[model samples]
Target: MTRLWNAPDDFPDEMLAGFVAASGRWIRQVPGGVVRSTRDPRPTVSVVIGGGSGHYPAFGGLVGPGLAHGAAVGNPFSSPSARQVESVARAAHQGRGVLLSYGNYAGDVLHFSEAEAALRADGIDCRTVRVTDDIFSAPADRADQRRGIAGDFTVFRIAGAAAAAGLGLDAVESLASRANARTRSMGVAFSGCNLPGVDEPLFTVPDGRMAIGLGIHGEPGIAEVDLPTADGLAQLLVERLLADEEVPLPDGPSSARVVALLNGLGSVKYEELYVVYRRVAELLDVAGVVVADPHVGEYCTSFDMAGVSLTLLWLDDELERLWFTPADTPAFRTGSVRTSLPRPAAAASTERPDGPLPRASAESRQLAARIVTALDAGHAAIDAAAEELGRIDAVAGDGDHGVGMRRGTRAASHAAAAVAQRGAGASTTLNAAADAWSDKAGGTSGAIWGVILRAVGRELGDEADPTAEDLVRGLNRAVEGVTSYGKATVGDKTLVDALVPLADTFAAAVGAGADPALAWSKAAAAATRAAAATADLLPRMGRARTHGERSQGTPDPGAVSLAVLARVVEQSLSPVD
Candidate 1:
């Protein structure tokens, strides 16, 4: 249990603050995360790596002389926002190009891709390599879909080494991709982890049983069996890894050489790990594999999870050489590092003069006030249903949907209220809310809501009051944006499943001469029905796709949240009797 915290929501920020204060020798505080306090003597490709904040050494602890140049940390079990990633990359860039690497989760991919686009727009040469090395997440035929686990260390180390060697962005990316291709990892959990203030663990295993093929983000394992002894467990791990012939062994003279890591997820102590690794070593030797630079400790972890994982990096000449490169960081360290001068402090920003608001019609300002009321209602609705939503999502997903939705809606409501109080128009208020929701929430739901609100805001300009036709048009644009950006369709068991029906129904009602309030009410009802019908769907997108059968009896959490918000907004719009 996570007992020490000011507030559950403040845990990530508080943890990061203490980390920077204690580790000032290696890292410095930045807008999104920490960056290396010292600089290399010469320019090199910046290796920026990150993900959600629960994994300690994985992100912040790895920022140092020969490892990651910076890390973009996010909320617990949530990917960093695009704005966050962009800020860290900008701070870490040293005239040379940047390489962004992280686990291959859906939210991480979306935000990182957005940051990559933004960096390119600013003329910064940036590239991305997603780590997909968890063997059990997907079959060999769909290796690209696997989640990244402890194998992230192999990929990050190689990328950082290539960069420190003064390789160009192209070469660095190639080496990181190669590292990911050669690495394989599998994890088992004896128990689940608890979030900061949550009363229970995300999942649990029966006594004397163990879960296999678990994920780091509080997801339960795919299969469970009776627990085995230390030696038997080592054999199970080794045999499973050796059975995967699809990831062929290293070629040439190094065909039998490999780098093995026995990683503790979180609560498993060092002594127990040593016991397991003892037998793991014997099995590898018997199988004719020569281990090089074997590591046995925590590398990547779930917060306080009782689990361990085994990672094997099949090595060739170049990889083996890179693996032995010296590194100095707060967590992992190797051979001695060369002395380097401290980086110069960043220039302080001067406060800019405030500007007057753009003129807007009184009618538009009146509608903006209503928009704020609707946002408040949406926040209330999500807050009330958050626990239930989390329960539904935990069936197959990471179980953070409810928490994310609550955060987004709360931010959106506050932003909308502040902008509306300043006499802002409907468009400006919605746009402010959209940006706040996305920035604070930081996940797939955040990104999708940002798109939905922004698309609608564009159609509700400040010049005039919006009509039923305008509302329908804005909703249509939102639907188009979501489908295009998220690549999800009606039956994919996502928010799009409910969003599509709601938009189509509203558009039809408005076209038939119904008022905006009536159209919205009808649409909200349709969305509710659509959300409930998702219980029968097999999820074909996002993390749920990996455990599709597990989600069969639960409606999609995204769809349910969308419907709940729509109903609340509709109530705010309808005229009281």
Candidate 2:
């Protein structure tokens, strides 16, 4: 590395200690690897953001107008000292109140709390905001335990700008909380990062796999899985972000869409970052997840580590307007983005659905019962997987896919059980039974369930002993319907990736003179393989693509669930000789 002192003649002030020192007074540091200061906070508002040393653009580089008024740098992966935090608070408070912000971490909390106390003792009116934007870090109810990650920059930028605009401490505090609520983040670490001055990385995970919840400093994760290509990773992030939405106040997604940021750690190239951002923006755009203000760059980092984090901030009207408000800064700059939050719509009919109609046979109803039983048998795994997936989707797609699927499957089973009691026909019974699924499921699953059962009803139209030939026809139509209804194809990282291929295989076996049992077996087997194959594809179309390469290897739960359904259907179709 070139020596800064000996660099040729006139180097940029950014690299000079005099410039750094003159920019602000030496405020103290805070918790979670953050530093703080009040000293000469530029333009109007005082801001704070800090982390460890190596991630340059982070703790120190963000200090400028419209950014941090002060930073509280921690000791590498540790928290900043209390004195450091106190200095920041003292510097930031200029009688107009001071705004303190940083990523959520234990050390940061400890130090910042001390700083808050010290500030009040010194008669300075200071308020601190914690960044807890990562949806994957903890359950929403337990978000206080989550690590803030990169989305902290958005919260700081917006809130800091507002404070500069002369909003009092209350307004700043409210804006900060609202932005934090609107924001969610998730990240995948391919390789562990080294702690400065250490001989080795903090920990290690196998190459070509992702550490799903690896802390910025190499904490253990919810799970570790094979690495994905870039598109797959992007989709994973996007899916989690959308899933984290609060059901959009009973209105559609347009009202729910908000400002989004695609942040890269220090090591990720801008080239790769933009590639991820473009695909994610398109996915969000298609899904109606708004992009009022879109930021794509390295706003945070883990010391040149080869990984990235995804963050979404759900904007209310005030947040949207504030996020776009003009304020110059060395790191963040933006214009206005129109954000809307729709009023909650009154719910539709609440009556228990009409009793299952006639037409669904005892056998088919039995099939539904069996599927439900299988799900029930694996309830723990289902719930766990759903929880994990829900966390994942919270980063990228509509957040409720897990809960939605769980609800849909359980409701379908319940409806079948109810219909069985009433002796409803296979077609009518299943149709009415599916009403619960349609009403209960949300997002893509809701639409998929509607098509799936409609095809079943079509084949069973008032028939006695509808043969496997009838089943084949229904399956074929179902595949076509899924393709048509979703407008997503096999490689788009969708359930169709498994469903279409399975249906085709089943139809081919039947056409080649195989018996119903044999054909069904072939299709079920094909579906299992196809579902696994999806891990190899990127989420080119949906929330999965935003996860990019990080999504590879983890089979999509929807596709896997579909395969399971095929297996159940095939077994049900077989009869004793």
Task: Give the poorly placed runs of model 2, Cα more than 4 Å off.
Answer: 1-45, 245-252, 334-577
lDDT of each: 0.88, 0.61
Best by TM-score: 1
TM-score for every candidate vs. truth?
A: 0.96, 0.52
* Candidate 2, 226-341: lDDT as tens digits: 88878888888888777764433356555665767777765678899888888888888878877877777787777646678887777767776766666444455455322312
Error of 2 at 508 (Å): 81
Best by lDDT: 1
lDDT of 1 by residue, 394-416 (tens): 88887888888888999999988
Alpha carbon lDDT at 299, candidate 1: 93
